[model samples]
Target chain A: MAPRSIFLLSSSRVHGYEFLEHAKEHLKEFLSKRKVKTVLFIPYAQSDYNKYTELVENTLKPWGYKVEGIHAKSNPIQAVLQAEALFVGGGNTFVLLKALYDANLIPIIRERVLQKGIPYIGSSAGTNVATLSIHTTNDMPVTFPPSFEALRLVPFNINPHYLDPDATTCHKGETRDERINEFIEYHKKQVLGLREGTALLVEGDIATLIGDRNAKLFLPNKEQAEFAPNSDMSFLLNKT
Target chain B: MAPRSIFLLSSSRVHGYEFLEHAKEHLKEFLSKRKVKTVLFIPYAQSDYNKYTELVENTLKPWGYKVEGIHAKSNPIQAVLQAEALFVGGGNTFVLLKALYDANLIPIIRERVLQKGIPYIGSSAGTNVATLSIHTTNDMPVTFPPSFEALRLVPFNINPHYLDPDATTCHKGETRDERINEFIEYHKKQVLGLREGTALLVEGDIATLIGDRNAKLFLPNKEQAEFAPNSDMSFLLNKT
Candidate 1:
């Protein structure tokens, strides 16, 4: 298998940051390393494709990268084939996966990232699809995709924008940790709880946690462990 | 169609309350008004059906209700048909709906509630299944049911344990309001956000909001509204 370059971002914007501003340096380094010129943006997660694409374009323009929306292209699959890199923006995971399935782009996108070694950038919902499935996503199922199956760029599932339980909260909804625990209770797969502002950058078989906050990992029948920023997470990529 | 008798509880346990403690009065009145003797318990949302049933049985025993686990019966369908009243306990909505689907009980249960006029009580996940679909649930997609389609006992969807945004948080994940807004964006259905310790009680054609807190209602193309406790919510039932 060819070495793959993937950036799974927890969120596009952290609190008090402009759109994609928190991820500026990392995005620049990843795209520069791949020598990417123009990036194809999957904005199907949002209702307004052009508007979403514009947001990404505006944010990345200063970084010396050109951005285009796949929705605008007459032939999306062909666009993927010719693209230097891919950027899937953050929004509802259900809507994003359903659009990907509707356009018949799942397999092609998977091939581009896994086989062709095109650098793939995913924020929130995008990060979700890059995983094995979107089973652990925090988004509501506003829409139904044909399947929860995703790109499988990574072996394990991811819970992006992972929030810890507020000690003072009185809300009775299951805590983020509890929800992940329930997910593992039935599906015997590891789930990485990617805290907000964190990103998992995988180059070939080596994966590294890329933020200040600790990333929590959950496996069935095992106590969850947390990884600090810059810790090597290559073991996750090696699983199955 | 006969008027459905239903209690859509936001949660089984509220903060500082024991299991079913916050809902004891509402549960007692609903079952008592219907003259229910033995309550059929569906504990599929949980891995341990027996343990879940016991918890409910213990909670309702003092209220003069005999709680029986549907899982214990030789014929689960027969159990629903013969149940004086039905109680669906809180847990994972995905697991609960899938088990109901696996047993082919969705139609039978709906018929029992809508046609037979038997009282149906739902807590959290249970409340989610009693509505048109489980799309608005706060629970993770821990497991995928065959479809997001759920029992159409009500015209709209209910988001049980609906939470308000934490103004102090730094997390960029979509808040509960944003999630419901996303659901309405695609589905065009009204979603009632049932806060913990709140419930919607329907008897015949009228539904009333119960508890001290107000319930939030999300409708497509309109500003979300909140209904104070004891408000007449029968308008929600007449939508379809």
Candidate 2:
């Protein structure tokens, strides 16, 4: 079996979705060679079926990919097992988790996508769950009331909406860097502070950053550094 | 047995020692009229045990209340069963949850404190845990990755460090009200948007807002209301 690919898109605010267009092209090319039809999963949109399905169908259909929204009430487990590709859209992380949990689709999705080698692409909450845990998500727990347990797709944490320090302003509140630093200090976990427009492309044990410039790497007890995109997806894959 | 009176503080910015002072007063008041002398529980100051223990003891000793800060090596279940009151201080919710999980203290604390009716007081992470869940905490999960499961001391969710909408702000980002509104839209859970110096006093399933004027009450599908600190506590308690 070809190694499954996982893409974690930063939140949509920073052109995260725009980069998805390029990603879709690559995905289409990969799937075409395999003679497989791409299948998109929108677990977060299950609550508002019509709206979410329309959004997913509208976005993926244009790329010549077949997309279907799986509502939890209707054989969600079967949907996961049969899908060739899963694309979880960004929304409220808590709401997404609740739907996943309610539908009992968490384990099924994990089994099929993570262990079964189905390609997975997630933005925002979708990306948030693609980590060992969803503790570092920028979205307030209020948006989706998290259970903290995620899909464990990656070993390290994902700091989506990774913002650089603003030097011109003296914002007394904790900066994004400070917050990630605090997480590193306590948890001692490696984190990928992905700026918007950045995506981590993972194929089996190889994980690489695509789009934008270098992303900030955060490791416990080590100084954070910005490294060029495409340096090594291996760091992410090896950790898992 | 007399119903144990518990005070759940909603403030997060207080220094450890400063908090210890207020805790000592409350403990003294509780113990002065009771036969209890010792209080066993976790502290928010995990890294610096000696310093935290000193601060805890300094205040408790003066009031003749024995205070023991459980160590990483200590069995939290054993400590909870023996303690008269459980004091959970404010800190990162994720860090606290990790410690609680590592120590296997959550079930024990819930059993002893909630089921057994041992007096409990929490602030910040402590306060967050006192609610039905910790899903609404404003603290970045990076600093304190949360599981969102809490002690359910109250039926409602809590947004500690709750700031009123500042009309003067020019920043395009969502305000605190807007964030809570987003949360209400998704979860439809009752949230007590607590300001600094505010406390939620719970007595026998009754929760009253104490301190600060006009704390905001966010209800699902209802208009937000400004509740005076001295307003009837039953209004909140009855919602459950």
Candidate 1 wrongly placed segments (more than 4 Å): none
Q: Can you write out model 2's per-residue Cα lDDT over A121-144, one digit (the tens) per residue?
A: 787778887787776766666643
What local lDDT score does residue A176 receive in model 2, on the 0 to 100 scale? 72
Taken over the whole model, the C-alpha lDDT of each candidate is: 0.91, 0.68
Which candidate comes out best when scored by TM-score? 1
Give the lowest summed-lDDT range of ten residues in model 1 chain A. Answer: A164-173
Pairs with steric clashes in candidate 2 = A94-A144, A94-A145, A95-A144, A207-A233, A208-A233, B94-B144, B94-B145
Worst 10 residues of 1 chain B by lDDT: B217-226
Docking class of 1: high
lDDT by residue for model 2 (B1-240), tens? 344356776663433235445345544665565566876646752456667666667766777877788764265677777787877776566667667766677788777765666888777777787777767776666533345577665667887767777676423234577667767776787788877666777766666677644678888874787888756665565554
Residue-level error in angstroms, candidate 1, position A198: 1.0
DockQ, cand. 1: 0.86
In model 1, state the lDDT of residue B162. 85
* Cα-based TM-score, every candidate: 0.98, 0.73
